[model samples]
Target: MTSPSQILLVFPVGECGGAESVFMAIARHLDRSRFEPAAWFLRTGPLVEEVRTLGVNVFLHPITRLSDPVNFWRTVKAGRRLIIDAHIRLVLSSLGYGHLYGGIAAHQAGVDAVWWQHGIASPMNLIDQLAVSIPAKMIITSSRVAARAHVEVFGMNGIRLEVIHPGVEIAPDHPDRVASRQVVLDELGIQPGKVVIAAISRLQPGKGQDIFIRSASSALRRYPQVMFLLVGSEMFGMDRGYELRLKRLAVDLGIEDKIVFTGFRRDVPRLLEAIDIFVHPATAPESFGLSVVEAMAAGKPVIVTDVGGPRETVIDGQTGLIVQPNNEQQLSEAIETLLANAQLREQLGRSARDYAGAHFSQRTMIEKVEAALHSVLEADTATKAQRHEEGR
Candidate 1:
């Protein structure tokens, strides 16, 4: 029997952000009988240890800055050596640094490369230009909106772009709903019977936590029993003082007592169980809205902005409600509508749970990703054979 092909996965960050979580899911669930996966982290953090616990080989080579000439080439050399030594058949990378460095290493090592595109494509930077110029076999995006954004910005050139929505693990029962809600209420010193509404994302300006707070203020006027949660922490100093600003905004809106900021949670699934309603109000176009799908997997009715990937996942009044981005009144109205109608909430939650289970389960995502990877390898092999035949 032929041995499983060795595939090297590259990540620019070793922190468990949404993109890193997607990478970990891939590593944890990939089919070992068909492919053996290893990882190289460009920056070392908690995620390196998390991946190690999964029993996948993890290599940490801290890259200070990719812009530095010496730093760039040295890391490329190290990556090339690792790929060659591991007999890597294909390189799959995440984020920009991963694409640029991993693509170079795979090119040098005579292997095909693919990258996960985790952001909405914007104006091309120098790094973006360089990364896009690499001869990667595929560029995998998590949503059709994201894929279209890339085409609008870069025009794809000749690269193959595949849309693979992010997924969550679906459970047979919501066993923790009551227990998790009690735990959160006790932890936050809130009394019982209050409805929990939450927005889960890092405290970034683009994440629109302030908008959530503003809407929460409006919702509180109608439903005094509603409690709001902002769950997640800032990362990489990108949103310095952003959390403080959000807190101040909540205070200014006179809803500080009604909101809880659970910074940097590791227990998102449990939190989702505690949540009665989930909200994602990103000011910018989100790439995939992993948290929105996660809430759906938890059987929670969600309210998301009609800006990006979340709009595509929800059927607007069927699966969940979709509101205009940054519109505090619309968001508040949606929240009030759900809170007023328990039957509607239950119906939407059931539909969302069914939709998420059928289309966005981890098993489904892994199957799609595995097929795409195999197709890339097959196409590369066919191209090589054609080149050899022509040369002969």
Candidate 2:
């Protein structure tokens, strides 16, 4: 099948978050001969460099703030110029003001637009709704629940909504497992044969890092060799209070030395390789649990909170365990269970890896994204032709 000539993606953040990860995966794995992909980010950060390293053209839009009227219009003009100069046929946006700006700019440039929903934040304003709903040919959501939320909360039923699950690449084997385990263990001053329970996510209250630490405190008594590895940095602009709080909680519980904070490590796939078990105890709804998927892809058993997207990804007790969100006791119990039964862990891990490989490969994600883009572009063309006929 033929691919669109050129596609432009606009996103609000510059960091390597879940949506950005999916966007980069799609950009890297998409059929390059058919589709020329470019990206525009509001500010420069890790994602910009990552995308560029993948040989995708990236532009820095440099919007000071969403409320800055002059900068906002300037961004619109810049986006229009990008669309025209690049011969962009489609504009895909992730979320926030970027969606509104990208949709408006695409309309101004006479290009098809799609707003890719990545989260369920606040409702869109009237202007944003019109910019996103009227100018955009379709709305692409990462999950079915997110699509339904778009329709129910924002009243954007006029726009077509398509769900495309994000994908992850499974390593041929846990290639970095040995090296990463040695490095992590050495850095933590821990020895071999210690059970590692790893959870990687941005340090935030909603992410439940504190809950994990507190739960680990109790769980460590039974399994003193168990090391709790917290992998990730604090969220952008958020205070370091959460990180400090977790540390304090661990010290107060007398499990401080057993807990290790590896701040924002780039080798997450490798880190997942080294860990014995993975847990995601997010207190809030996760639109899609990319970290959990990554862990599963690494052939590790997972225990995620039974909320939002994890419910779709994790099959409780079969693939991995799913405990109630914010229940530290239950979380600890699940972790201990996986640690105690090596055979059960191996079985679940194998199932997880197989399930992730079958359902969440990068190729699968790119195909779904390409199909959505094709559908949106074709629908736009048909709508234009109908309008022309009616005018005649």
Query: Which candidate wins on lDDT?
Result: 1
The digit string of per-residue lDDT tens for model 1 on 1-392 reads: 87878889998987778898888999999999988899999988888999999999998888877668898889999999999999899999997668999999999999999989888887755666678888788999989999998899889788899999988899888555687678967887778888899999988988888889999999898898899999998986576889999999988888888999999989898788777899999888888899999999888999999889998899999999999998999999999999999999999999999999998999988888899988988898899999999999
Cα lDDT, model 2, residue 153: 75
Task: Tell me, by TM-score, which candidate is best.
Answer: 1
lDDT of 2 by residue, 191-256 (tens): 888878988989988888888998898798888888889998886567667788888898899998
Candidate 1 wrongly placed segments (more than 4 Å):
124-126, 174-176, 387-392
Each candidate: what lDDT? 0.89, 0.83
Clashing pairs in 1: none
